[model samples]
Target: MATSPLQTPISTRRAAILQRTGEALEARLEAERERIGLWLPVALGAGIAAWFALPAHAHWIGLLLALAAGLLFGLLVGWHSRLGRSLFVGSGAAAAGILLIWTRALWVAAPVLAAPVTTSFSAIVERVEPLPARGQVRILALPQRRSDLPPRVRLTLRAGQAAGLAEGETIGVRTRLMPPPTASLPGGYDFAQRAWFDGIGAVGTILGEVSRVPGKEAAAPPLRTRLSAHIQGEVEGSAGGIAAALVTGDRGAISEADEEAMRRSGLAHLLSISGLHVTAVVGFAMLLAMRLLALNRRLALAGLVLPLAAAAGALAGGGYTWLAGAEVPTLRSFIAALLVLVAFLMGREALTLRLVAAGALIVLIWRPEALVGPSFQLSFAAVTAIIALHEGPPMQRFLARRDEPWLFRLGRGIAGLLITGLVVEVALAPIALFHFHKAGLYGALANVVAIPLTTFVIMPAEALALLFDSVGLGAPFWWVAEQALRALIALAHGVANAPGAVATMPNFPPWGFAFAVFGGLWILLWRTRWRYAGAVPLAIGMAALLAAPRPDLLVTGDGRHIAAALPDGGYALLRDRAGDYVRDTVAEAAGVDAPLLALAELGHVECNRDFCRWAQGEGSARRIILASHGRDRIEGADMAAACAAADVVISDRWLPHECVGRWITIDRDSLAETGGLAIYLGEAPEAVAALRAGDAHPWRLPQQLSGNDEAVPKAALAR
Candidate 1:
């Protein structure tokens, strides 16, 4: 360079290139070091936090100790590292803080022990069973099972005469209390699990005798309860009983026809203190608060008034119902309303993803057991969708345009309704299938009509009724409210009975539900394109759906009769009792309307004394024949002969047959010259295999055997 800068040429150029390369490599290394230093501590902290937040029954002392160790290790790593040592140390400390918080939470929960058995008490009849055929009665009373008492303990009375019971009637009963049961079969409702999280346990009706006690009428209802009751009474007194229920969660006064109408129209959620009801109350309250605040110059006054308004709304919505003897849904609503108020107080222009996540995290951490409940899942799912949709560019752009025509505004409103319907439907469909095995086809349409009417008319009317009652003008308002409610009920009923209002699907396996939920959450929460990876679970669910096996036979009513579909494309009925459930079960599983019609169309329906006879006539006899009762002795004998000739026979009760072949037992043992196979319907995998292997002709046996043959094959097998 000293000699001549330009003349140094090739050697200089090569040195320069090498230097640049080295600098680039060093920069990359430094960046990598910094990234690791930052993220590693965060990961560690999250792990520690999770460990501490483990269920109350989980070991926490060991976890806390391990978290301390992790912090020490992280600190050592930072000290040893040259680049970004401060960053590493800071991250480690932050992680340690997170872990400490979780650990402290765990300790706080340690005091909660298993609930002790307490003396059983009685409940007064508040409402009779809405569905008489279902034989369920609902009661409200003080439950002695303090540990197992639901936030709102409603007794489900079985095999009891609820008809004569009126409101304010008390009855005593004895029963052992326990947590509600989990869903054991696919597509089965997990009412027990829901009740458990809500703090309910096993509830039974009075066994031998029930003595009715006089109900104590309140001289003056407490301020809040009085207001609620007054609102309800006034609305029903004026508009109709149905209207009061739609607004006040006082469905006891609603007529049976109105209740049915609401269910059919999918407007039932509006009548309950669910998320929608809460949202309406909060939304209107917020609007009113904003207007009032706009009029007030003092910022302090605005803040106080706003929060007070929110609290008032929460009260009106039944958010604090549990504390005031209302309902669980009301409590949930209150929690959500509080979250919204907090967001507003924070001066946020829009609800952020972080805030939503934080709210959900707080709720989940506080009530982890709520994860098992359909209400929590469905409510949160709907909220999440609302948040996402509200933030989307399309919605934002639409809202930004203020100069749009009235027609366009109406169109936008309609669009909003459709979007809401689609989002909620998608979110709840999986849960509905998992729980109810049926989907409401017109849920969206029902919501469109029901939500608006309830929000603008019913709820407001009830609120006004309360004011009128306070001023001694209760009777007039009550009559008006009742009439309005009647109209709403009629609307719901009409929509519910409309053609194709509900779609019933085959019961899916529990794992299918699990995967579907996982997929949905992943899609909803994950921020990256990689989130699409959740589709894998969805695909697996679809595959499961396709792979589901159809049952060959279904028996209902104490298994005295059966409806069977033969391989020869024929349907046969062999039952000592009516086959309605069996027929419906088969039709539902097959996704066919009028299975009998299909059978007739295919010329498979035949009047026969024995299913085996029908099978033999068509030369397409099944390898196995399951008889619900032992009444078909001749059929049983023929089935045994078939078993001797490479077939299998399964019966609910023992069948007497001497000329049959060797019997195949589930233990893989062959009984000499009996032809009767004693294959345990409910056996372990190994036992099933043993039975199959020990049998001389395994393939000749029924393709499958199950206790509940009507259930989908995978679900039945899982049981």
Candidate 2:
């Protein structure tokens, strides 16, 4: 077909305009990449995500490809040549994927997973701490024979039976070690991956009696461990636990009830060694050093006073980190503080998102698996949002009026704290929902009281207590610290007990989380009006809370119990009092408020010890039956009734042959193979096995299906 000359020019002009627009967009993207200084962290995070997206044990291929792509990108970056939009996007994504694959491969390289075994071996106890449950303790041990395994393996034992065990003592253990549990459903928690990164090769309970053995030479108890024990020995009750937690990052001694209170009140962050603690420690040291220097006029005039004070503050932070055992969160705080110090020394603004990004990059490069943890996400999100909000024009305008009266300054300070707390809470709400499926509603009210008390009273007393301990005069200071902690605990409990103080929601899907995260990063990272566009994704992410589909039934991974969705937007339990954790997990996932009450109020479910029956739809719908241990001739009547009444049956014991023709029976063998099941009810009911719904991966072990695995209802037999 021939075209007119006028039409041809118009098409050509349109093509040119489109090309120019694309070039402008590319230019804008490039400018953003340079301005944000977040490329490395984003790339690293993307790599981790890519690794998770792949099939288990398939990271090797991805690693190789990532290596090649990384090298190519490095060369291009080194050449100082402008990249086209396609090349830039491709190279960036490829580079990120490479890091993810590398991290996964590195994780798999642990010797325990290389050649897993389940045999008894003598090990040396590195440390021992009591579990939340009474009469149980967790022991961190070093294996004598399996030197190829991880440096540490966590073992559980009955404290009453293993009372003689001590740190640095050799002990004989008889246990079958196994890998950690994987996610029961997609986007669920992956304890196996977490354990892998924690350097825990295997986890198991002690089988036989513990006996003292002489295998390895004794080593001294860790300095941090000794200090924690000393603190515990000195004080009593929750106060001692709080004191130890503040000083040594050991919260094992804290009671579960108190821990729950803190979590519900949003004072949980106070217990963790984070930026707040680091800042308080450093500020105290800096102020004391400066005052001492002022007292000595000659030293103050030496011109090294400022530098020395900065170094002293940094040294104080490092000392506190060492005291806290240098855990991941503390390490992150130390690195961030160090970056800020360096930036200040260089005569640059230390408070910026770039500092946070730098800290994140360092942590990711050191331990990429941290990207998956709630602590990392929450810490980084809170810090980033605070910095973005405070550094922006809004805060600057609010604080622009300077040299006000003392009372006015005090009021402004309180206002600033309120604003900061609100921003942090809002920013981290999505992450809390995605990871924990809940948000602390009255957290702001609690924080208003707890934060000031902790920062001003509790932390200072702790510092003085530690200082006095070095001089063997710590009792009075320690008492003061305990008093502060007591007050803080009381506040947390009171606030947590408030009605409607916690909001629970279903776990957001991975894509939903991604949308929220990107939306947040968009608002935080961008320097233009386009940042407001982030609200689109944020809204979509929030919509997921209402859009997520609720399962008709939730079965535990071990298949001990199941919860059926009720018409009143609650769950009905098949059992009254077994598998509380499992029941709570299911209820939390379904966003149920009171699991026990929901179960108690179920009118549709009718059951005894032998059999239970429930129907979802009115007519012509499949009926559900829970068949327990009833295999005798008398119980045959119950089985026959279930077969006649229900279309699908889940039995704890063996199923009789006569029932197989009439119903789809999920017996013991089926559950042992599948782990769990989620049944969805509709016009056509569908039962999805937890194992079948998930990918075949290392974290999730394989289950063998025997020839008898197939059990179809007689209604579908003709088909």
Candidate 3:
């Protein structure tokens, strides 16, 4: 087994090269050890947030597991000098911190859980805003007599119901209070949890007319509410709504069509008070401060310019956070901006994963429930992707070259924007599909044009207008802001109307989302060639998303409506002109755009009053009937024949025992427990139903889950 001299030398060199590569990888990891370790808390925080989604009885198990891990990590940290276990200690601290915060969230939600539901209440109108409908309005009121409930409650009023009502005015309203909604489907959106975090105990519609009541308190509205009303009055029409949203986060004023256009064109982020708006405010304040400092010789010479500028930026960001209601996304952005300003003062780069982690940690600590929101997902995903691209190997190699001149900085800036837009679009696409079941076709191009306009033109004008209003000289500034907003809205409409502006995709499964999230985090956090391995999960996630299947039948959360997909590819509504939100949700889940209005354009869906039935052939799985009437109306000979003919029957009425035959029937009892059901057409009647989990979570009262025997499922008995 003797080898030739040439072969031996080549083998030796190959071995040396492999050794060098391994050393280099280790060195890179060592360099980033602290930064990578900073995210230990972030991961723990996410785990804690997810813990709330579990069944109520399962919480003790999670708490025990958390404690075990914390104890284990602490032990490891005790042997730190020998094992380099500082990162372990940090992770343990993070896990403990999150556990405490989760407990706090439950405690905060307790009073609301204990609140009683009543039909009449007297309250002070804390705030009021126009709803999307012509004459509807949303009121945020403070309950005066209900000591057990949370202080704030939200109510919807019909047209002319609150004609003369204003914020801070006491009013007597007769309304039936209802709990915040549970998930529409199993693992779906949980409005109950969101309401818990928002401090809203109940939601209701005002009955009849609202009557004025005498109150001793002042009738002046909060500063932010008054500002929003003033902006709406001055700006006029949809543009005014846009202005109000930019300044006060009152997006309810925007019409449905305009809002849809913005969403389709990927410009909807402009309406939210997020990273872009916060950064603009901070940048403007920083610039103004730097300029002001330059005029002072003593301060400028004392190296105080950067520090002063950072202080000003912090003040502006804090002010904007308050004005925007300190919502989850806005608060996340403010924390990040504050971190960046601090980095700038410390002579370090602001764009780093550590800063993002710090911001996320703070936000999760305050409101762990935010982890489930689209805003939190979208904001964090976009920022992480952009930062990864900036710090990637390719970008580093490009920056290593020193031949470029300063005059080309503008071109480089433009190129950077294009790259960032592309990166962010790609990163956020999977998340959008998982959440909304659609992706904007022109999002990248739209962002390229809209981002700069929003950042430099619209937001700045709005900020200036807000500033001017404080001095009673806001009219001219508002006019300028309106012009900018008009241009932006027009651009959104134009882009949205373009051919193939949005692509409807089937909703990705939870497993697919997990893969994508982990893959992206791996690529961003790891500093070695091993990071490339993340692409494996990324590709798998994309494939899963593309291959996901759509359900054949969809039932609304209230069980008041249902839709069945026809063999010919159109969706038929169970009721005419009702359940608009439900219809749209089902359509999105089915990977169809505009289910209600565009259903005709895509395919035909016949509607009627009593029932909507669809059948492909004489098979049990192919025939489906949804009845809206009661048993008395549907149990007649004609109705019995029709019901007996179908293999699947869904009704809001009670079905007789004799009626249960070789078929699957969902009636009042079933619908009462299961919020909704998604049925997939198959030979065996395969389907999934979403039921209200009878559990002891903070949002679910023990009494509500205890006495609901009808919520249990029962298999059919053979005759």
Candidate 4:
């Protein structure tokens, strides 16, 4: 195919153009080559993502392909096939990621509670989580001598019932334990799957009483829990709960209002044990160790100060991680922090995309499930954005201006914080929306103050208080910590209460989120000018809401709650007395935040004790929805009439054969398979269910739900 220039004499202009284009591409690729290794984790994550997106039937095939890729990659390497090696290696890494999660899932498999049981059991209390705000206590326990029960179960009881119980106490519990809950709505979080992975087969509430076991002895309370209790005691009110969260990673005591305030203000990350808290602990420990060691002239002369300080930092970080319950996010930050300290000891560039990739790769191997979590995405995105920011010329200049006046440097530092916060907010917006359906628009503004206050005042003071508490001299430090926490909480409340502080949208399409994630990575991972092109996909993702409007009808997994949007920009509920929690969740999922008015209250829909009829659209284009309200099912005669008239009929109970809807009929049996239904009405309507096609995972639904779904329209299984 290649003719020499002399054999196929091209025009001079065309030749010049081709040569210039080739040169430009070569230059771009050369830049990419410098950071090509960073793509390794991206490839690995891609495989993991593919596994989750895949149906249960395809899982084994995914594992096999990964194995094949690995074998092929080894062959290519041994054959010295350099060109083929790159292709196989990338695919092999991805495939390996698939195998990683598959193996992990199997490795952690445990029995799930099949049905609800209300009985008394002698259980060793593994952990007692206090919820002062809600006046509840969550008990993680191990049932003894009960072969019928799972090894571990979680119980929620009134705080007063378990007031004296601690981590090691053996307690008698009379509780109702049921299988962990599935997604509350279509695409909602799967508590059952997470519970399965956590070895918790059941979650329930104490129905009768909690008392100490006579035979077993209770050990001394754990230092972590003790610290949490002490911190909360030292600080008054809800601020104490936040302070405890900062120091111990236990957020059980935070009030609903405070949590909401913090979330809306974008300061919720402070409540979770992650980067900022870990960095503070490590950096402070290192600085303190270095300063103390420098006083030893011999240690300073031998140049062991930095190494020893780094060791101290690593030890402290590990300790803190353990104290924080070693949750995924805390563990992830600990690993990354450990790596950074190692890089420091090596006298290498400490922060780089390469470092970020390595950290991500390690976490993926250890806990591949974290790849799909918001914590992993948000934490990594923030760190990547900050590191990439420093690569920009403006930051390079700012960082290099060490000799500038102190006041000017202070001003510059504040400006840098503002810019960094803004940049991070933009990067995290899509992720927040994807997970929580809301993004704190003013999170950047809140973080500017909250971050500094937490880092410099609250956390440090809390640390000192803990240190001095060993000798009863911690009161002053405790006071200092409390005041700082009060300020932080106040700041959160103030920022969150502001108008338009957070923006919520409906569920964004998975395809759009994928594109946005890819585009964001492209911009942050590469240094070439091609990075600008990432904006195109990012724009497409942000425009997803406009492409699809809000759902016309929504129903809960239990079919107890149903809501529809009214023409007046409000909500009409089939149930006049739906619980606020159920109503709000459905409303938020439908991309609206409005009060729900009963169908009886809304003139557009006709409602009575037995049934409700809603007319959508006008003239021949209209669709009639006849919903069973007070009764489980319509009478045979009424059912036939409804079948002939209504476009769709919804019932929480099984309907007769004669009740076939003109377009679609959703009854108890259908709801049993679908879990939940979100139907968007239009010329060609679509329905999204809580359970998608081939969702036969044990944690998703009961095996008994294998009733033929072929009769249900395909749209009901839409993602």
Candidate 5:
């Protein structure tokens, strides 16, 4: 008979409890041990991130990194606890990642254009990507006879100017070229770094019609261009562009409206030629090869179909990857697909976190710089999430799909697809928000239909079309594919237009992003009760991201646009006449969807020919002085009065020191150094009162400050 708790000896009860606790601890350790190596990629990525995070101007960073390397090396070789050893391995991997990226950066570094220029130049067109809807063509050309210029320049030609130009052809043009641009705002995409890596020094726009010599013989155009032209010629409207993107990885012909719709609907991944596309292509090729080989009785008896199928899959994946331009994401997907094919050959389960981890490791080793990109993160995260979901006990049983009725099996398939879509969407949400400041709210729902449509209907039709097109009998299949694309594009636009489809927010704090990533990895990589603990940090990160304060005012690097938060819940621009690039950048950073209002039209400011003063805050707590009209130089007494009366003075022109404002004085000199400034009012958080565009790197050195390059005041830089 079992004794009651009160009747049992205290020592025995304590012993039982302690034994159970020990068992649990051991189980937890075992679970961690099972997948600890998977964290190697994460560690490597962290190292890459650390390298990017450190200021390039910091001379001691190298020494700091050396110390870290020594510590990690010691931990890696030393005998330690299992958890401790795993942690050390991760650290060592990170060190390796840092070194890899450093080497890659130096290897790919190329000369960049320092300033804008206008010249008449002859160039050999290496590539010509047409933009039919926009009546333009973008060409990547090797400029001739100019050693000072970069190896290549990307240029755009308007309708008339682009006539008769093709890849591998030579043409002359008079154009104004600009150095590749830095981020328009802090943490935005930097085109200059990408340009430097791609060996593009400048981007240009033709001033007039291009000068093409008469009867000039040139090499044939690239296969990709001809393929795109052929597909577009056969298919009409936007479907042709979609077909081209799917087939040749060229989206230049896709209409801007349709592209934006895809982005909003979260269907843009379809055009990216990643895992979905590669897997579909590989799977079809394997199935086809297996079926054809199985027709032979000897081959079937020998069971060679499976082996041949694996080979075919591998070949198909590699060929498609190359054909699709082999970008980082595509390469990562291809690696994963190849692993899947290998799994088939070895008779092992293909969908597993190990597969994801291995693919990630290969990619990080090959392209360490890609660690910072949204594509790499999204592709890996989505695949990992799906695999983790399948690894769960419930999913394992559900996916077994025993001998059931056809209807029930179909229902299970639908349910599985929906579940996977939701899981992928959840996995990608934080990544999307972190990089893009936006997330698709209904992306999963849209993809539920879109993915199957593309995989089972559209892609198969396209394949059949391509096969039959050699015999000129592909019209029927092409028509079917075109109809499917119409449905897909319609779905994209419809979902994008739905209410609350896209969620936008202010640029969240980097620390919050770090927390989210850590939490996500913890949850996805482990299979123990402790993994749920990750949700706490994840929730906290989401809170911080959603609740972060918005800035009250923003000043562009050039001091050409100054935007302020309006009392009624939008932003008012100092100048609305400027191009949409700056306007859109400011809007995105501000995290508002409303169009910027013209400050002058707001009718709240009192203005003179020299300046305009907007009284803000309780009892005019903050008076903002905005320089106006063609005047910047102010007489001593007048400037002193202006400064004393206003709390903040913002001007693109030089402001004298004697006329310092009551609070902050911002001028062209300060703007030149700061790049851009986002100022927060109210009870400013410890370090969030003002944020700058951050320190410059090699390709993004600060522009020169005009009118006495004197250092900005300490008070101005303090926040």
Candidate 6:
């Protein structure tokens, strides 16, 4: 064995290399096993939850049948290794879950089929479109129809009359009832799905005669609403309207400039009834209750007093946690509070993971649709990450060091804010890209300042204002509250407008969302020294998002102008004439910023007219025209003439006449353009050329408009 020294060295080197490789392989296998172990139970629980939460119309029998089949399949798999047996169980549960899901889908479709004939209805206006434009109204109707109404609700109207309608106003309207619109892209906002879950069968505007129902008042505002309103009024009376919104999240009074400041500063969420606001209110209430209880046995009545007081605080603070429209973060706070109350009464430990999981399970069972909502995803991600980071040995030890100074505390808070923001953003980035196609670059910076202010200042002040109002000394407190609100609004607007505040993203598939979420969960749940392994899916998700294809055009509707299209797959902004703030809206909804930049960089020539035209040469093929006219005509030429031989036509209004060739409408277009195969966006000339260049059958044009008697244009040919 020791024949030569050189042989011995070579043998040792080979042994070392083999040992290292084997260790790596073993480690990978262990990770996979751990992952499966953790996920299997969660998946089974989810499956069971899904099964039990099926709606009334779901096919219970079908699901049971599927369960039976899955059980048999599981038994077959169980004949193999123990791991296979566990997997088989999980698979059986998953099969039942899938069956239930399918049943639910069928159930949802039943109403559409059974009740094909839709009825019209009239209702009072509860909330107007937050942003301005003509006739975009969010009305609550009584499920009745009226004669002499527009077939389709008219969203756009002339300025003055349309803007006059206010929240809490009753109005008569006739509308065609239908489901909410489905998402056009994967991972997109399923407005229809949300509406289905919310029980909104159809949504439309007012028509026919305008009549007011006297004495038929709106549903008495919730207790919180009344208190909030009272506080807002008091604040406006003393400080101003702008001041009121900053304190109370009632932005109806704030000035445009202040609003803009808050947005630019990334503090806009402070003004809204979100997690920050709710958590602050809850924490304050808890502290007050604890202090009051410590006074004496006589004052420390535990039965219902404390709970009642907390409930009152919740209600006064706009039912911060109980708001139907609240996002997942706020809901989590509410559930956590409920759990704490329960634990306090039952003499159990406080704030345990099991309690959190129970609360989450309850929510998921109640509203399965929320599983896909941004608020739910982001909130859970942040909470999970925080828990993981806190539990880590190094962080735990660091925090245990009591010698840390006030500066350290402050620094820690800031760091926590940034970390939380980054975690939530990473979890949500995929969906954001898939949905809005943009990212808030300064979201973390904005949160660092705004979050603390919201928790420590604005919300607390608002709560105080409400208390003062209840105590009959409302005026002084209201004034202070309003002033605080104004300040908050100013902060948000400032943050929103800051340079490099937002970055536009490319659209991605829904699967990207699944990957991102899985990666996040893996990182948060894994207990290992090499935590970076969790970044694999996160990285892939981001890469997938970056590589997503850009839309040929972006169309935006402020619920008024049918839609605004932007060339180069960027954003388009629809003007809000009434000056209502547009939240989380993107410019890309109107037009593509990247292509617009590219055009500028390439020194494309510009043409002056109602239609702003950019061109390089006659045959260069990249032609973009921004049609700005309201009437849909320019210099004796209709949209058809203006768009003739054009590759892409971006317009503010819809045009029916430009369906003859490969024209991409910017905003509005007739059904013909959307349904007809003759026109397409020229945004990617290469793709268009490829389609035309091939010796293949062209896209078939419709013989007639679907459901319409109109014939298809003979000259129209799809390429």
Q: Which candidate achieves the best lDDT against the true structure?
A: 4
Q: Is 2 or 4 the stronger prediction by lDDT?
A: 4
Scored by TM-score, the top model is 4
Predictions in order: lDDT = 0.49, 0.71, 0.71, 0.80, 0.78, 0.48
Ranking by lDDT: 4, 5, 3, 2, 1, 6
Give the range where candidate 5 is weakest over 10 consecutive residues by summed lDDT.
Answer: 703-712
- Clash totals for all models, in order? 20, 1, 0, 0, 0, 49
Taking the tens digit of each residue's C-alpha lDDT, what string does model 2 give over 561-664?
Answer: 66777766777766676555666567666666665443434676666656666675455654555545334443455457657666667666656665552345
Cα lDDT of model 6 by residue, 451-485, tens digit: 66656765566557566766677566555555655
* Candidates 1 and 2 compared by TM-score, better number: 2
- What's the CA RMSD for each of the models? 12.8, 7.9, 8.4, 6.9, 8.3, 10.7
- Per-residue alpha-carbon lDDT of candidate 1 for residues 161-182, written as tens digits (9 for 90 to 100): 4434555555555443333333
- Order candidates by TM-score, high to low: 4, 5, 2, 3, 6, 1
Model 5 CA lDDT for position 687: 17
* Residue 520 Cα positional deviation in candidate 4, in Å, after optimal superposition: 0.6
Evaluated against the true structure, the overall lDDT of model 4 is 0.80
Q: Which stretches in model 4 have alpha-carbon errors above 4 Å?
A: 1-28, 59-84, 215-217, 402-406, 617-621, 631-634, 701-719
The parts of candidate 5 lying over 4 Å away from their true place are: 1-27, 57-80, 402-405, 606-612, 616-644, 653-660, 685-696, 701-719
How close to the true structure is residue 83 of candidate 2, measured as C-alpha lDDT? 43
Clashing pairs in 3: none
